[model samples]
Target: DELQAQKAAIQRETDLADESPEAQAIQEAKSEVDSNNKTSTTHIDSEKEPSAEEIAIAQTAVKAEARNHDLANPSASGEDTKSKSETETEKLAAAAKAKKDRINNNNEVASNTKNLMQEEAIKASNNSDVPNLVTNLNQSQASD
Candidate 1:
């Protein structure tokens, strides 16, 4: 009979996820006590979630750790420290810049490779064998 009543009460509430005061009253009333604890029936209260401040602190800590890691290993790419909700214009600009960057980067790599190959070819062509001065030295066991 108690279970049936609880079911009917929950049915009346309709949305269990609703956290408004009136909904909470309905939910609290429907909350059942453990069968083992027959001495008294107690409402089941869920553990409260972390506050905004707590969430901010956690976010800050994670950002700090990432900043430290980036600092320790300095790489070619630079990352932003702050998180922002990008506007539509900013997003489109970023996308365009990324495409332009890819093209430029490929060209830069090819140019660098060509310059390096030319320098190596020039060095190889200029090879004039200079005689080892040590070979012309006397090999006698006498004192210097």
Candidate 2:
């Protein structure tokens, strides 16, 4: 019974480990590598050498498969592929732009808040029956 319980515990742990994101990523990478190796290795019988036409056909098939793979995962191949330095530079630029945008947004919000508070204060001060001196003076001057 103890051995069975230990086995069950180990199996549960293994199941949990397999379900982890890191394990999943590793599995996916391994599968991709395996598939790539399988696609690249052309099987041949040692007794019979392949003809020129057969070799050409195999090469063509390999090329087609590679092209299809590139098409299916554009980031894995072609112009989208970037050097580490280039990728880091792009990331830094994006981060800087985001920070600048956030600062600008905050400044705008602060300015808006300040303007709103000033407007509210003015409205509150004008709540009395007395007319605002500056506004009345301006209106009187305009009438004159």
Best by TM-score: 2
- Scored against the true structure, residue 79 in model 1 reaches a CA lDDT of 56
Q: Each prediction's TM-score against the native?
A: 0.18, 0.31
Tens-digit per-residue lDDT, 44-75, candidate 2: 55789889999999999998998877765645
**Model 1 score (lDDT):** 0.69
- For candidate 2, the per-residue lDDT at 78 reads 61
lDDT of 2: 0.83
Candidate 2 ranges with C-alpha deviation above 4 Å: 44-144
* Per-residue lDDT of model 1, residues 1-144, tens digit only: 999999999986766558678878766666644344664535443577878998999999998988877755655235554236456668889999998787567988668766777744334455577655565356573335
